[model samples]
Target: MSASQALGGPSRCGWVLGPSLDKIIKNVAWRKHSQLVAACKSALDKLDSVVDDPVDPASCTPLYGLSTSDTDFVLQPLIMALDSASPKVVEPALDCSFRLFSLGLIRCEIDTPTPTPSPSPSPNPSSHSHIFRLIDSVCKCGALGDEAIELAVLRVLLSAIRSPYVLVRGDCLVHIVRSCYNVYLGGMNGTNQICAKSVLAQMMIIVFTRVEENSMMVDFKTVSVAELLEFTDRNLNEGSSIQIAQNFLNEIVDVKSKEGIAESKLCLQLEYDNSEKKGEPIDGEPGEGADLSGYSKIREDGFMLFKNLCKLSMKFSSQEHGDDNILLRGKVLSLELLKVIMDNAGPIWRSNERSSVVKSVDTSVNLDNKEDAASDDLCISKPRRSTRIVIPPKRLDSYLWAGRKSREQGKS
Candidate 1:
């Protein structure tokens, strides 16, 4: 049994531990390739199984039981396997590479034992370039592999776009977007072009919705966003690009509106009850509290996006020759204009609401412990918690704001 199995973890019957595996990898030549490939898969499988503890969170302990030197010994052989001409060796190897890459564990940190003295070429490739080649292989898999392989490749590709390393994320986006446009330039593979466009749209939504300013900064220099926008503008009716853009815009507007309300609500009580429990004196008076206009930054950022989207709508509007395209463009244009007007009007409306609600009320008028007593006699009684007010009316302000903005823009 291997060390992993000795520790009561999963392992194959003939599993070899680190030193034996290392000897096999370093000594095995290309002439006797089957043993080398099988050994490589076994090492990867061991690492995979080490990470399969029910006790540990998924992908949380990627290096699990392996030391720095041992990890290098394991991964170096697998990188070598990528050069093999045999599909049998390449397929499983690629799958393992994708698994490790997706978990952000493909690159072993330099602190690991037997560190590379300097960067070297293929057969002794550096970690970064190796990962680049691995993902590149996955992208090319679609041409020869089935839909399952293609989608698995795309899924891993998308995860890379969300990587913590800014450069890595940026490069992944550039590859996908450029590949899509390159297909168009090559004037072949309509299916591949459609696949690329769809993935691009999904990727855009993920970035705009889930990412932060730092990630957005990384994308500013990349051609992906511009290429995707150009593709949409030129082939608006050819694929699902237009609908994707429209849906993305709607989601952004909806999400921004929700955040505005949640983050800028009226504070009913200035002093939180928890501070009183800890016997700490709170600073604020009965009414003076955090600014209700706290959502200014959010509004500003959202408005910038909304403005850019409206510009896109205008561009599409100019090219509308067909009745159907014109109708779709008009609907999107109307929503975009509405987004602008709503953003402008929000602060004014919020200011009025703030002023009206700023007046101080006697704290004593609120529900007290004495009010909960069943008997009239003044005795200690449990405090009744405040009843939450539920407003039943559906919020139609966002919809109305869009309509009003469209009308105003039309008049202007």
Candidate 2:
């Protein structure tokens, strides 16, 4: 009558109601019996009905139509197979979970509760535990050179990052960062390389915007930027390190403080409004300027973060041309940090400009210097495989003709 009996029993509901199946697997000494493994493999194939068509073309999940008991029956076996030692069982298990997660059948949980002693345990497994197990399976597959599995897992992780739950987003971010770090350390293979690039690009966009705007809401304290830099430094040689540091610095310069402040206000307002909609406090008094205080604090912290990053980069960038006494050398002791402050502290910088506190120089004099700096910046910023201008070689006759014309004109 239970889910497990349905799986091993001769009934249509066996595959549909199978959480009780875990009890049978637990009861049997399957670890010691070769026949039990074969039976599990066969049972898994049948229970994995949603592996191929979890969601229809319109992104509708047919699983929602199923009764709650039926959903539990289907998900339980897949969750169990995720931990199966056999790759055959694990593959379909992963496929089923990925499909269900992608189809929105299982919502990502914010908190994963630890199992404790209880009089009665529920047959249903926690979605949180399922997700963690799925991620574990993904890492194992990647280690075993299962490129396809890695890509599937990445898609699921990306979906989880968009969850409204902050904890879910943080967990997803950790998974992505770990994936990227692994790719960096192990050297990304073909399919996994593509998967990593796709994931990293999405992650960078999310992190950059989220950190720039709702710095308070999105928790990134768990992910250490310094640790990321160190990991990247280990994988990168001196030349590459200099280039990455230079490129990041150039990107920083291109970020405009005025636009950033405006964007921050918009994002903060949205966050406050959303919180209120969800019946949560706005963190401060609800008014036009409620978020202003938070925004200012975030701005200050952002400036400090950038200042620290630039200082850290200086240590790395020095390796490129230590003897040349680079740009940081002999400069106003605190000028670099000052520039960062000015760039981010729009009010102070704008006030100084208005009061003529900062001197202006002729544009033409700095034109050559600007061009050189632009070129250097481009070396780091632009894609290496960019379109280039190709000039044709001038023929000797063209030069001679021009010389003869000049002589004739002068004589005339």
Candidate 3:
């Protein structure tokens, strides 16, 4: 008889732990074991047939009347295989994530349908949280076939911005900002790419817009300062971590204030244009500049926005440790931003360095305000450059600081 008939119907884990099924499950486990490698390689062929569409009603036609938890039960093991390092495991994992994302099962997927709410109170709970988490892990893998992971990550960030519920929506925007700070400050353990100044500028523009939307609807009493600080302490170390939280808070405040948001947006757009025109060959400044006020402002704004997020989570009316809650956002964004700052900052910083020095050199030489030949000779005229790239906010500074830090890393 089949195992289901013989063993008192299908057990919760499905399939009996006999030699054949055990062999199947054991082979797919991701643990780095020398002994099981060859067997797992062969079992990969069966992954699609077994677990590819556990949630798809058409695929599992026999279980049309099955409960949601049962459907998840059948699919969870398949995804668990995704966490494994085996090539076989990664393929199915990525496949599942991609499929889930496409099906509107991920936050990025559902987020598109959600329009920006007015400065109003509204709620829209996603039908499924597992899908969100699954998509999240897949996007975090740092690599994807053909498509860049950054684009995938960006889509996720954008989705959060578009969510309808105040707490949930703010949570998403908060993450984008956290990523921004990570990119700006060198906190991501040298894993992320630093953006071009142009990218950074555009990011600020996006963030400034969202902060205003979120700030208007916020119930500031949701999470208190003490609880937020505790949460921050539990999840993040000081260094760039706490600082990122602070920047987010400031950005929210800036966005809410018409005068503040407007000025920052214009300046951000200008900087973005300049960076794009400058291109990818930023070599480095000849001498250290006296100030870091610009970078600091971005950080401070980021922290403030994040602080408010923390407040919301702790004090939410029915909050019960929703992982997607704003207070939990810092960790997610922190790690994401850290990766960008590590990868993209150096070349960008170098490209701008020469220009900054040349400008300084020109200013110093032309004390008489003459269109002098010497200063003119020193400053080579270059054509204006334009790139269509728009960076998400806080992301720019996160990487910029990383680039600068990497430059000085040798000295330290």
Ordering by TM-score: 2, 1, 3
Query: What TM-score does candidate 3 reach?
Result: 0.28
Candidate 1 deviant stretches above 4 angstroms: 2-68, 77-82, 85-89, 101-130, 139-152, 163-173, 179-192, 208-212, 215-412
TM-score of each: 0.36, 0.37, 0.28
lDDT of each: 0.36, 0.36, 0.32
lDDT comparing candidate 1 with the true structure: 0.36
Residue 291 CA displacement from its true place in model 3, Å: 37
Local accuracy of candidate 2 as per-residue lDDT tens digits, 1-412: 3554434243233333243344434544566544544555455445544332324211112233333343444544554554454455455555544444443344333223345843542223444454555555554454444545555455545444432221233333444445543542343343344334334434443343343554433422222222223311232343344344334323322322211233233433443333312121121122332232333323323323333323322333433444442223212112222222222222332233221111111010121223232222101111112111111112212322333345346448
- The better candidate by lDDT, 1 or 3, is 1
Show model 2 residue runs off by greater than 4 Å: 1-73, 110-127, 162-167, 206-412
Note the residue pairs that clash in candidate 2: 4-20, 4-21, 6-14
List of clashing residue pairs for candidate 1: 68-112, 68-113, 69-113, 338-402
lDDT of 1 by residue, 268-287 (tens): 01111111222221121123
Cα lDDT tens digits for candidate 3, 100-127? 3222222211211235543531122232
lDDT of 1 at 294: 30
Which whole-number lDDT from 0 to 100 does residue 130 have in model 1?
42
